[model samples]
Target chain A: MEPIIIEGTPKTPTIKFDSSKGEFEIKGRSIPENSVEFYKPLVDWLDLYKESPLNKTVVNIRLEYFNTSSSKCILDVFKKLEAIHKAKNDVEVNWYYEEDDEDMLEAGEDYESIIRVPFKMIEIVE
Target chain B: MSFNVESYFSDISSGNPIHFYKGNIDSDLINKVLDTVEGKLIKGNEHSKLRKKVYNVLVESLQNLYHHVDKVPDDFEDQTSDKFGILEVIKEENGYRIITGNFVQADNVEKLEEKIKRINRSSHEEITELYKFILNHQRISSKGGGGLGLVDIARKTGNRLEYQFKKYNEESSFFYLNIFVSENY
Candidate 1:
């Protein structure tokens, strides 16, 4: 499958998903007005990726700030990955938050609670 | 409509007006508002946490206005009726206040008021639970609103949602929301 590589903007995140390498990353701020429109393609790609099996799938989320709309969409993205993990595949989520950002940390924890995937809360020191 | 729109605008126009806008609210305007406000917060040397909190809440507030604002009264002047709304950022001694004004259909007022009151009355833990429940169960609306914006705003600010509804006419009313971003937490 072809990789999904999109650059980040002030209102969106950088998305780099490589199926061959089994690594996916989303970084930066996500406060788009229409989050569903922005995230629809990625969610669709994940659906397709779930069809093929990978030895291990690693996902990284490094978001400084995301609006409530983006928050819901982010959860949707995680739910898709959770399905992949539940299918007996090796899926790991690395959630990165800045040091002293309790909100972002809690956000990661929120997803961890809802999704059935293991999450590593990595704190980035500024 | 007993609500004096002119006086309300004049009343909030006081204080250190960091930024004020009254017109059509589109995606472009939302980006500009976020950029300008984030720049001001950075220049003011606000703590990163507080800055992010304010940015997060502000994004929700502005997007709410963009999606929920109703049409302007036909007789009303200054016709920017396409998603017409008012936004004011004031610098108080204690913290920054983000005030947004928009028109709402009279029929929808009761539901919206009850929603705000419920949020204002919920404890932090309760709000968190409510947020989680909705995130897990609620379907995203056609407008891309998951009914989580208000709840998320309250959770982030740790403050009650202050609001007012001024009767504009039998068909519509002016709704104002005052959200404070304090340095205390």
Candidate 2:
């Protein structure tokens, strides 16, 4: 699949999903004006990815902040991953947070506890 | 009933330290407010980190107002009545202060207070875990009543939640929440 790239703003994050490298990275802030509209394509792509199936899928999330609607969309993305995992494909989510950012790290753990996929919480020095 | 519209505008637009918006809540107004805040924030040379925090807080607070504020039909007989809340941002000595106020039924205040307290008490790790748990297990409430918004705000601020409540009338009270994100902190 063609890579998905979105520019990040103070209010939004940059999303880079490279299908060829099997790497999906979401970075920056995510407070879009319309969460549903902004996230529609990413969700759609994930749905398609599930059908074709990859040997291994890695999702990297390094979001500094996201609004509630964006939070919901993130959940939707994780749910899709869970579905893919249920189908017996290798999938992992690497959640990155600033070293002092306890909230982001806790958020990663929260997502990890709920989904069956392996979630790695990494602290990066900013 | 007579309405003191002039006084209302004066109270909001006067040379008060805080810039306040008071009136009907809608998406258009929310965006407008964000634009105004963005202009001021960037002027202070806040760069990307401060700007992102301010933007996220603005969105969450406005969403709270839009979803929780009591509303009556536009054509209601009491045209003077206002249904929405107020949002204010002030420049403080150390950093920016964001404040939101709205009227809520008395019954709902306790739940909200409890949620804020829980967020304040939670460790960074706990907050992260809580966010994920809510994502997987909590169903989004109809009419946007869920606590996910508050969770997002708390996570973004990375500071203790500050709030107060004042009785507005017999059946309801005005809830005020103030969050401070210091430039140096």
Candidate 3:
């Protein structure tokens, strides 16, 4: 499948899904007015990828901030990844937060508790 | 309705306001608001935790204004009634305060008031449970939210949601919501 590469805007995050490289990343702020619509294609892509899986999939999520609506849409993204992980694929989520950002760290923990995948909390020194 | 530039400036100037605007809410506007707030927060001397928390709260608060702003009444005596709103970020000695105000239909104010009152009264534990429960059971509203922004703001602060509704004639009311992020937290 073709990869999804969306440039980041101030109100939306950049999404890069390289099927060939087995790496997916969502970086920057995600507070889109229409979050459900904004994330629909990315969610749809993961659904199609379920059929042909990579040996190891690393998903990097580094968001400076996201609104409540974006939070739900983000959960939808994680749910898709959970399915892949449950199918026995090597799926790992690298949840990055800036150093001393306790709120972001706890947000990652919230997803980790709900999803079965191993979440690595990576702290960026900024 | 005509905007009071004088009073708006006075309210913001009462404190060390970093950003203040009252106008349309769109992608560009949201981006500009967050950009200015984030840059200001990073340049300040607050702890990383407080800075990030305040930024997150500001994001949600501003988005609320964007999605939930009621259309200015047809008889609002203005031609530029495009879901306008107001936002102000003021600096305090101990923390930062975010003040956001928007127009809401008079009929919607009762329910909104009740929701905020419930959030203000909930303990931290109850709030966490309420937030989780809403995440699991609540359907996303047509407005692209699950009605969690205010609750999430309360949870992030671990305090009451300061809010008020001022009567704007009979058809609409101006809703004011405020959140404070303290350094000690």
* Predicted model with the maximum DockQ: 1
Q: Rate the local accuracy (lDDT) of all candidates.
A: 0.88, 0.74, 0.83
**Steric clash pairs (candidate 2):** A12-A29, A13-A29, A106-B128, A106-B129, A107-B128, A110-B132, A111-B132
Q: Candidate 3, residues A1-126: lDDT per residue as tens digits?
A: 999999998778999999888899999988777888899999999999877879899999999888778888888888888999898999999999988777788778878877789999999986
lDDT for A37 in candidate 3 is 88
Off by over 4 Å in 3: B1-14
Q: Looking at model 2 chain B, which ten-residue stretch has the lowest summed lDDT?
A: B1-10
Arrange candidates, best TM-score first. 1, 3, 2
For lDDT, the strongest prediction is 1
Q: What are the models' TM-scores?
A: 0.96, 0.72, 0.89
TM-score, cand. 3: 0.89
Candidates' RMSD to native: 1.6, 5.0, 2.7
Most TM-score-accurate candidate: 1
Over B42-156, each residue of candidate 3 has an lDDT whose tens digit, in order, gives: 8886777788778888888877877788887666544484768888889888889898888799999999998998888888878877877777567679877668899888988
Show where candidate 1 strays beyond 4 Å. B1-6, B9-15
Local accuracy of candidate 1 as per-residue lDDT tens digits, A31-114? 888899999999999999999859799999999888888888898889889989999999999999999899899899989999
Report the lDDT of model 1 for residue A33. Answer: 85
Instruction: Place model 1 in a CAPRI quality band.
Output: medium
Clashes of each: 0, 7, 0
